[model samples]
Target: MRRDELEGAVREALSHQVAVARPLSADPAGQAIRRAKRIRRRRTGAGLALAAVATVLVSTGMAQLGGDPGRQGKPVVVIGDPNPSGRPIPSATVTAAAPTSETPVDVLAGATLIGVSGGRLELPGVGPAERAHLLPSGGWLVVGAPTTAGRSLWVAQHDGLVQVLLAGAGSIVVAPDGRQVAWRDGTGLLVAGVVGTQLIGPVRTPVPGKAEPVRFIGDNVLVRLDPDGPGHTLWRPGVGELTAGSDRSTLNVYGALPDGRLVGQVSTDDPAKTCLAVLDPKRDLKPVLTGCGPELSPDGAGAVSGDGRWLLVNGWVGKTSGSLLVDLRRLGQDLTAVPAGPPVSGEVAWRTESEATYVDGAGKLVQVNVDQVRTGKVAEPVSVPGVRPGDRPVLVTG
Candidate 1:
């Protein structure tokens, strides 16, 4: 046979054999395509998972380092129960007889004072109080001499509960919010709050002397004073100390305003006269009111109204002097005398912008209306019993 004819016959015979073979459902081309698609999907899923992990890691790093690390994860640490002894005190409710100028007053029964309306309550602890401050939350921060050897500082709640914060505390001051407290243990200044207690310093640092907490400059920062010197130190929890105020003569800081203005008495060169001054650390220390004598109160501390609009001065006028109410807005104005039958001793607290409450010499709680005194009119004094002559009364509002 011829070569071309034989090649054609072979090709035809091969085509016939391919058609007669068994058919396969799994085609090589289709299998290759599905395998490639599966590989592509796996790569895509892995890339997305890696991206998500990276995002989480970046966010966690920012939160750990960018903000205040000390306060980030810190929990509130409760020191003790406000009321240790489970016995509840009687709640007193006082209602006004009629609309009168007399401010509602209450006397301290033990360490608790229940107001006429029952809304104002102050539990200053059960023990005899050496020093006490009315908290903004209608509670009391009290320093008591519970034992013969040591002093106790406590935060007493309005619900007849008391929590002893420090046992051997010396000098202590509560913050404006009533949430934080700072006290002195020998030479060390310690601060405590819901977060916990932190020691600021011995204040003496390189030397040996005493230090005390003056007042809270801000919510988180406080001003500390060294009795031996005239300068003041600013203390923050995480941050170290910073110097505040000038190195002038030592000024006793009593109260502080929200704007960081300090209200206190400044010692003068003349021993006969001292002056009440409002100091701004950013400015020069100048006296706002001069020619002030000794304080009538035992602690020699004055009271500043909650609004920071008025100041109650307890100056000595022989032995019959009463506390003077001065308008903070009008610093040059004369002080209005709080009317009492006899000389008023102890501290006076502002019940309202125009009203003040104080304990008189006869151990009576007297409420004085400043507007009436300014107009030469005397509102009948509302006398409250149970408050002793030396009992320091502080006015509180709900």
Candidate 2:
């Protein structure tokens, strides 16, 4: 099957569809618009393999709804009762995980590229950066501070050379391994591999009207369509296929583990009732575990430790600000929520396997240890050398 023919078939399958917007109140990403009518289109199984390849050709239309290897090929787990517990789990006795060999990445102060450990990586041409991500190659991907003209992404080489990657780019996210990046552009979602200071093999794939890249699980980039909605699509760059998103309608994917399991909120039949579920993306988004509670919702900012053992999320516990620390090793069964000061920023960066740092309401960096969280203790907030009260820091970890 040729690329053009595959794309043409996809167009024919989608021609009858008309998109209508509806509002969803329980959207995890906050406000969101839902599709009122969906045209159920299907294609022959034989063409499924080719559909994945056609996605890389850079089309302006949606990918074919054929068999996505990432979703269709994996076995789905059937649980007799999805949620055995009818109520929210406020706390649990956590089992400690074996130490891992994963190396932790350093925290870089906002735009300035100042490392928390020490020293600064000066980006020559790039203006004050609002966001900085550590690349696997020991470089940095920074988003220039926004102005009346909008923001852009710039790459600073390990040797201190700087160059702009994309202009008017937002929702920019680097893969967990720091090899690939995906961001929203005027046309749609664009993804590319990073090698040193240059982007290799950039591919533009069409997505919904409003979308944001959530995180990467291996080569597949999870994207949330509808901007404010829970709707998501897993863009598989390795196979060049953009999946129809999770088949589960109520599941709102937030953070992902290194092994490709997704940690997110699952809404029940009742909108007010929601719980955390760990989903295996390869297994058709099957729920490996569920029923943590609404308090564990990431509320947009969530981070998984380098070893994929701990998941730290910022959210509300009752009326107070708090963070949920879940041990992924036990499939989210062992977890606890700790009261947090009003957050200076939503992001949380892990300093060690058991310790994570976040800016509190006082604009001071506060460290939270897993063991202390279990006993309801929080460390005193300390100030970072270069980060000022008004600065919002962006944290990345391997």
Q: What is every candidate's alpha-carbon RMSD to the true fold?
A: 27.3, 19.2
lDDT by residue (197-258, candidate 2, tens digit) is 34445676766566667777677777776655455667776566465655544346656666
- TM values, all candidates: 0.57, 0.65
Deviation from native of the Cα of residue 306 in model 2, angstroms: 3.4
Best by TM-score: 2
TM-score of 1: 0.57
Model 2, residue 154: what's the lDDT? 68
- In candidate 2, position 50 carries an lDDT of 24
In model 2, how large is the Cα lDDT of residue 305? 70
lDDT of 1 by residue, 1-398 (tens): 25574444335433331112122222222222223233221121111111111110110111111132232222112133222223232222222222232235433434544344332233423456644555543445665643644566655433333454455455566665555666554434556552111111222111125546666666544444566545455566545544444546435555555566766666667655556667765454444444343443333445677678767666555665556555666544553334332334445566676776766545556666766766656434444543445454443321
- For candidate 2, the lDDT comes to 0.53
Specify the highest-lDDT model's number: 2
